[model samples]
Target: MDDTFSPSRHGLGHSTNLVGRPSAWMASPGFNDAPVALHIWGVREMNPALFTMLDQAETLAEAGEAFLAYMVAMFGIDPEQRDAAPGSRKRFRSSFLRLIQGWGFDSNGPEGAVLKGWVESRFGILPSFHKEIIPDTQGPVWQAYVAERMQSRFHDNAILVQLDLLFEFCQWAVARFAYPGQSHLTLYRGINAVDRHGILEQQSRRAAVIRLNNLVSFSSDREVADCFGDRIITTRVPLAKVLFFPGLLPSPLLRGEREFLVLGGAFRVSIEDI
Candidate 1:
């Protein structure tokens, strides 16, 4: 008898090797081709209280608190648990405040040194030095210097990772609001960019979806819908993958319309067609 063929050595039961096998759960199931309804709404249409709270927040902490409150109210997150957790909303608020304050002060002082260290660690780049003409003044010159450094820093890979973490927090915060039977939600920032056609598009004219594994696995052709009050827009594509891009709610697009929060759902049709 060959020992290699023995059932005791190997097992009588059948086993499957799932390594490198494509997941059936990840399949699109033709959702991209299905017709989808869309909704376009002003800011006021979706959670007016949240809009009000955001508007009233004067400081970075206040603004972050308002955002967290909005998440709890809309998505049913436990406030105590969320606040106590590492990388909590409070931490994000603190980081945001630090970023702004760091830019306002002289880079040689204690606060400035800590800020520079943070930037170096988080962004993996030593920010280029800008000579300060005035001492300890948060004036236009300082603002310009900081802004220029920040813009350059934004190009770093580590910044993208930080942005992705922020986006993940945003998604986790609002995931409860996802449509029935859906386990994932998309989050994106609106952008204005020149396409291959050489046309300069307006803000909200293009959107860059957050680059998370769950969100990016789906086909780009798939559409999503969002509803705010009486307004709705459907048939949007999850085109570009991004992190830390701004203009999520462009001022020009929301000039006359009321403020509204963006939501995500699966639907059909390209965002450009809407």
Candidate 2:
């Protein structure tokens, strides 16, 4: 049982020496002005073996499985605990199976439909792209559209709760091991407060603009790249340190402004004296 639970055996060996540092980007002037909440982490280094495993995932299902395995290892969940814990194995199995089934184009598949349904039922919005009009030759266009829609709907408490879970997971991953480098792993989590009315109005207008743009740029056999001159760039940062919001509560700094409830502080396992 111990062997099955060992992180080292599961490719999560402790090699990277991660140290947490304050985020300079979060402290930059006017950084907090954006009407959105965000949590950013500055990972100085990551375990090469872990990266290898991540790279090996060929599909979303595989990636989901890998994620579950990593989480289990990181949390040091033994076999017995995994079996005994309510819904532990079931949750992992469901997610893994769902990922394997795949979220199809424009979320037409079961998983995507379910996700869309849940979001719509909870938040009263559904992400839709006119497949007949906009030739989503580049599959990611619709995916991006869905992501944007979800981001705009972040004002819902249910969505915020979901975000909290995601944030907690990241915190747990960072806490589990250290990166092999001089700098430490940094995790930044915050919510950007946006005016609900203003954002919805803007989103509606943006949809119109996108539609008009697509019509003008339409070509029967257009490649995704030519149709949309967009490229994704990835970057890695090693070290950074800065601090803002001196105390835990942001109320002191945001007295007259709209109040924002900070949720999900740094994730740690500790006992508190009641």
Candidate 3:
């Protein structure tokens, strides 16, 4: 499916050797804080092939599609069993790994090598997910179970849950990489955006200050309705030309032509507004 991420030595057969170590991937903040990781591998070593795919990808949509395909090949739950096990909430950590391998990652197989190479060449040699590393840890199962939950709750819009994960990665990057003084970074998956409510729910716990640019939009009106109804905490800054529906933002604080609403939860109103 990923022509760009296809292994260069495709005919040479798959290699079982996981080239790099998982400990190296631990550099990411997820490993430090959470008992489990978000993705199968680390981000340090970008695979030549994966990079090539990303480079050739024409538009944002195409890039996102390609990424989702990769995610499916690595994570998406079985469609048949998708609705079979209902109302089940599993751990995030175990679920994440199981999703990756469930996409068909085996240590012994031809496709395994190809997939591993695709993974390694794209993301770098991954750390061996040895059973010992997480011994006796009841870390939550992440992606797969989450995907299942989304599918059950939202039905056709299952991708929204995964999108939230991608944006969550962006948030993690901002929290960890951005300079301490740069707290004003824009929240790409904003609070008011309907589709972003899932992400905003997660962000409410961590971020105190966030930026909302004018360019942001969502997938559906229902998403917007879901957003406001969720009772998540966040503030929105309107762009110069843009104006949100007054009903959508019940607590609007207008400054000149633009409105800046402080939907209070974790954050207090600024002195100027107070």
RMSD to true structure for each model, in Å: 20.2, 21.5, 18.1
Candidate 3 per-residue C-alpha lDDT over 1-274 given as tens digits, one digit per residue, 9 for 90 to 100:
1101111111211233122334223222222223232332333233344335545665544544454455455445443332222223642322222222232322222222222323323223321112111111133422222233333333332333333343333333323332223423111121322332112123334443321111122111323323333233322221211112121211221211132111111111111110
Instruction: For candidate 1, write residues 126-196 as lDDT tens digits.
Output: 22223432222246744654555455322333433333233333332322221323432333222111121
Q: Which ranges in model 3 have alpha carbons more than 4 Å from their true place?
A: 1-41, 44-48, 75-274
* Two-way lDDT contest, 1 vs 2, winner: 1
Model 2 per-residue lDDT at 148:
46
Q: lDDT ranking from best to worst?
A: 1, 3, 2
As for TM-score, the candidate ahead, 1 or 3, is: 3
- The global C-alpha lDDT for each of the candidates, from Candidate 1 onward, is 0.29, 0.26, 0.27
Top TM-score hit: 3
* Per-model TM against the reference: 0.23, 0.24, 0.26
Better of 2 and 3 by TM-score: 3
